[model samples]
Every structure is written in C-alpha cells, then in structure tokens.
Target: MLRTITIGSCVSVQGLLVGQMADGKVMVRVDEKTYVGYPIPSKRAA
Candidate 1:
C-alpha cells in the first residue's frame, strides 16, 4: 500500500508503505531510499 507522511512541518513524502515504528512514525520507500515520518490522517467520506 502507498501512504503519505510528513517529514518535518512543511515537507511531505508519498511512497510505498514499508513499516510502522513504535514511536508512531511510519516508513516509506520512494526509490532506493526509505524515510520515516508521521503518517497523515486519511479523510473519510460521510
């Protein structure tokens, strides 16, 4: 699955879902590199 995460405050990344950390951060791989950040909340339709 693909997920989007925020790096700092303004930086955001979207890539393949790697794994989730115990600190509430998630990891994602864009190409050959992987990044860990806070996952963005998905919007739900009501």
Candidate 2:
C-alpha cells in the first residue's frame, strides 16, 4: 500500500508503506530511501 507522511512542517512524502513506529510515526520508502514521519489523515467520504 502507498501512504503519505509529513517529515516537517511543510515537507510531505508519498511512497510505499514500510512499517509503523511505536511513537505514532510511520515509515515510507521512496526509491531506495526510507523516511519516517507522521502519516496524513485520510479524508472520510461525505
């Protein structure tokens, strides 16, 4: 699955879902690199 995460206040990344951290952060891989950050909340259907 693909997920989007925010690394900084203005920086966001979208990549393949790697794993989830214990502190509520999530891991995502872009190309050969992996990044850990807070996942963006998905919008609910209205």
Q: Which structure among the candidates has the greatest TM-score? A: 1
lDDT (10s digit) by residue, model 2, range 1-46: 9999999899999999999999999999999999999999999999
Prediction 2 TM-score vs. true = 0.94
Per-residue lDDT value at 18 in model 1: 98
lDDT computed for candidate 2? 0.98
Scored by lDDT, model 1 comes in at 0.99
Kindly give the stretch of ten consecutive residues in candidate 2 with the minimal lDDT sum: 1-10
* lDDT agreement with native, every candidate: 0.99, 0.98
> For model 1, which pairs clash?
none
Candidate 1 differs from the real structure by a C-alpha RMSD in angstroms, to one decimal, of 0.4
